[model samples]
Target: MTALAALVDFWDEEIDRWVSGHAGVSDRLQPWFESYRGRGHGEVRLDAFPEPYTGRLIGNSTPVVMLGLNPGAAVPRFQAPGGVFFEQLKTLRYSEWAATVPYASKEWESIAGPNRFYQNRFAFARRLLGEPNWSIANGVYFELYPYHSSGVNASMEPPGDVIREFVLDPIGDLDTQHVFAFGKPWFSVPARIGLPPGRVLSAKWEIPSREARIYSLPSGQDLIVMAQNGYAGPPGAGDTEALARAIGLR
Candidate 1:
């Protein structure tokens, strides 16, 4: 089936389960989920709330490989400023969501927090992936498009083994290679397998190995992979061109 259809089916089946299990959700949220027909911003923040995550994931196309991470509070809500209808939904709080999420007067703060996260993540990814100019031509920003998760719940820390069994393994079979690891916590399994933090892996975590090389930010400094491979020094003018070439995007 098409990507959108698959998303719809997945969300319909799974999101309700999450809502039923989470105590914070309220009856009021049911309407928002039922009525939500993909308005406002396209990106969905995967915090503890089941509604938004399920809604977005089931609605939007699957990202390359979701960059696994603990849920982020800075994730953008629809009430962000600068866009039309900005602050439109602020006065009312969605019962199924966290009180900390943007509502009414909190619009400014919500917009600011997640804006930075989105921008920084976008900028960093473009720079790292050698797509510095991707946004320039489009008259828009370069964003890390495919990252996914259950949302920002550090408390529900899934062990690497559990993550492997459930989330990562199922999606690993897809054509997409590369599961970018944001940090050490998410890097455990990928690192153990010698795959780069952001590259693809086999459906089973026990595949032999591949040439996935991990790197640090700004300058791909230090030993990214355990193997003392060459250090990626700070980017010089020529380095930009070289990195773009490395990713075959230039």
Candidate 2:
């Protein structure tokens, strides 16, 4: 499918589940929530509800999907200032946004590029794989939370399962070789509501023997989950260098 079609499908499936109170995007937000008109002035603030995936899908084929908790508030050039609409926000496809950023766009064909809390992981990955073997140009980035969150503790849990179902299922539908899910689950299994909360498990929790933080979801697709915070070495869960060597599929 075309990237826009894939993006629309993702939004349709995910928005329906998360915004359970409403049938779909509120009529008032239809124009703004669906798409931003053009690149806006000032650094784009991606901190809005239901942010879209960022990064280009080479030939509409994204080999890797970097999963995180949510979009933190930022004044980065990678995004457009038109991101928010009546508290709701929309993000241009990352393939478009990355091209604008200085280095993220480097080697990667994006509208722009940027990151830090997110970049360290990529840098670490580059340390192991080097060049296009594992670059943003060959991957996509997204957070598990459908909405924005400056910190991990800010979001609620009820919608997490639905988020996981819509988002992860789509990635599974893709020919994705790896899905690096950063951070831990916010809720425990069989939450108070009796439903399993949405959670990305760390690799260490899956296998006691492996000194790494990467595991395979039931889909048979390799999913590299990190600690609640994506860190490497020491206080972090696993070393990206080791993960690079261990990622046999790539």
Candidate 3:
């Protein structure tokens, strides 16, 4: 099987194991699951416990890959199991579901309508690629950590195999042009995947001053890591053109 197909199978098996209440899987995900469950915050929910990856999986066409710290609580709170979103997730599997049900789909919007986190994150792709909507955009999103949580737990370390197979190997094998990775923690990803360290560059958005570090992979694709400010908070209005120029997209 191809690397991408293998990755899909990996996700399917993991999700199945998780949903079936596999003791090992439950034990593995307990920390992250309980972290949000025990927080005593009404807004924090864990109906959707683990999400390994989302968005359109890379295929024949070269896609822009967006990397994030982890799956946020924002999505699962709405798209819980038994809902249309989760139904699609179960039927199509993640990669196929993501491809079929783009973030712009009414099915997604109906459940998680106008989510600031997703909107802000996808804004970079919409602006940089000049795609008017995320539905038509050619991209995929992966997380450094795959579990869902309201807040990032710096101490939580994903299994080494998960890191290698899910994140690093797919990244190395995919035919991608540019990878826009958000969060300071991800600066080490390129190096971990065998690329040299990246050089940091700063970009000023409407909110805070954000940094975009650029790395060139051996395959000649560029990996641009940015501060988590814009995506985690509000949309960085007018960041497109300037960011495009800074990252050599313009």
Candidate 4:
């Protein structure tokens, strides 16, 4: 079978298993399944939790940069802007994206909406062009809090094998142009998945009035790292612009 068919089969079987694990799940889940299946283009796919994901994040387009965060159910872990986004390019499987993982709106609602990370990135894109039309590698699999992949939480780490089993295996064969890690917390996960080695930049783009030199890397790969420290600047904040300017894109 083709990869798409295999993905669908695997997703359906996995959902069935998850549904069977709970009482009265079939009754609760059938309606959702029907609704998703009814959509043409197979546009809708089932998240690991078997939730309805309307975003078309699985195709053959590669991402320019990737953003990641620790898995928590408190905030929006996977929110992309509207309009002709990129293709899924590849797929990754992790239990945190599944329904079995505990999710709550408390953290999900806290940040990442109109004025949070989503808007921040949107603004950055707008500044580059007039409108913001881009995709982000938002579906993150927390190292420790695998189930809570939406909000913020504190944990040392989880085993590497768990990460490999759920996330790494899925996107192992995918290709991407560049990987932009959002913060230090997630700097290591993308590389761990064998995507690319995204380099860390500085967050000192504040009003320093000092001439900060733009250090260019030898390779033209254009990998970058930024922090989401609530700064009222750019997506990567000063760091993002610095990288952009360094790459001569700004």
Ranking by TM-score: 3, 2, 4, 1
Model 4: lowest-lDDT 10 consecutive positions = 81-90
Q: Estimate each model's TM-score.
A: 0.38, 0.54, 0.75, 0.44
Whole-model Cα lDDT of every candidate shown, in order: 0.33, 0.44, 0.62, 0.35
The candidate with the higher TM-score, 2 or 3, is 3
Question: With candidate 4 superimposed using the best TM-score fit, by how many Å does residue 37's alpha carbon deviate from the native?
Answer: 36
Query: How would you encode candidate 3's per-residue C-alpha lDDT over 1-250 as one tens digit per residue?
Result: 7667778877777666544544144554444334322243333344664566676665637566777776776465335655566666556666676675356677667776765556666666777766676454465777876655677534434444555566656776677667777776666556555667778766666545566678886557777777745343312647666677776677
Give the candidate order by descending lDDT. 3, 2, 4, 1
- In candidate 3, the residue pairs with backbone N, CA or C atoms under 3 Å apart (3 or more residues apart, or in different chains) clash, namely none
Best prediction by TM-score: 3
> Lowest summed-lDDT stretch of 10 residues in model 1?
136-145
- Cα lDDT tens digits for candidate 1, 1-250: 6433443344444444443443232453333222212223323343333322211222123332224232333223442232312233233223222222222224545555444433443454466455665331111111111222323223223344434333444343333333343333343545443444553321221212212344432223212211112311122334334433544445
All models, RMSD in angstroms: 13.1, 9.3, 4.1, 12.7
Q: Residue-wise lDDT of candidate 2 within 105-170, one digit each (tens)? A: 342234324545556655654554555356545555655543443444322333434544545555
Q: What TM value does model 3 have?
A: 0.75
Q: What lDDT tens digits, residue by residue, belong to model 4 across residues 178-208?
A: 3344544444444444545543343346544
> By lDDT, who's the top model here?
3
Alpha-carbon deviation at 15 in model 2, angstroms = 11
